[model samples]
Target: DVKVTQSSRYLVKRTGEKVFLECVQDMDHENMFWYRQDPGLGLRLIYFSYDVKMKEKGDIPEGYSVSREKKERFSLILESASTNQTSMYLCASSSSGTGGSATNEKLFFGSGTQLSVL
Candidate 1:
């Protein structure tokens, strides 16, 4: 079975601290994504990578950056954590679909990392 594992299920940091969120996928997926869940905002995409060393900024990438140095690993970095950034971070991996169409892709999601910034 495919599995997406997040390094931490819960995290807390100060307002100005730097944060790292790690994710790994057992399956050799070509696409990896980072998203954050908020109360009314739903799931907002922060970053995504379609291949090793390739990354693209998603809808809300202002305070977040991603690293995809290896095929199976993707990391999300919060340069300076803020109170408004406290939310549930989710990591997902999916196989690249034919013709690069996302409609046929199935994503495997991690349990999530709940971060609290104070």
Candidate 2:
């Protein structure tokens, strides 16, 4: 089974502090993504990388950044944490192939990290 593991299931930090969230996938998938899920706004993509050392900014990248130094690892960074940045962060991976196991490929998700900024 494809597994995505997150470094932390929960995190707490104070405002103005820097925070990091790490994620690793075991399937050797080529695409990895970081998303912040909010109650009414839904899942908002923060960053994604299709290849090693290559990354693209998502819809909400203002307070977030991502690093993909290796094929199976992706990291999310919060430069200066704030109370408003508290949210559920999710990491997901998908195969690079056009179709994986079926006509449409499905994304495998990690358990998610709940970050609280005080």
Q: What is the C-alpha RMSD of each candidate to the true structure, in Å?
A: 1.6, 1.7
Backbone clash count for every predicted candidate, in the order shown: 0, 0
lDDT tens per residue, model 2, 1-118: 9999999999999999999999999998999999999999999999999999999999999988889999999999999999999999999999866634554357899999999999
TM-score of each: 0.94, 0.94
Deviation from truth (RMSD, Å), model 1: 1.6
Ten contiguous residues minimizing lDDT sum, candidate 1? 95-104
Each model's lDDT comes to: 0.95, 0.94
- Candidate 2 error regions (>4 Å): 99-104
Off by over 4 Å in 1: 99-104
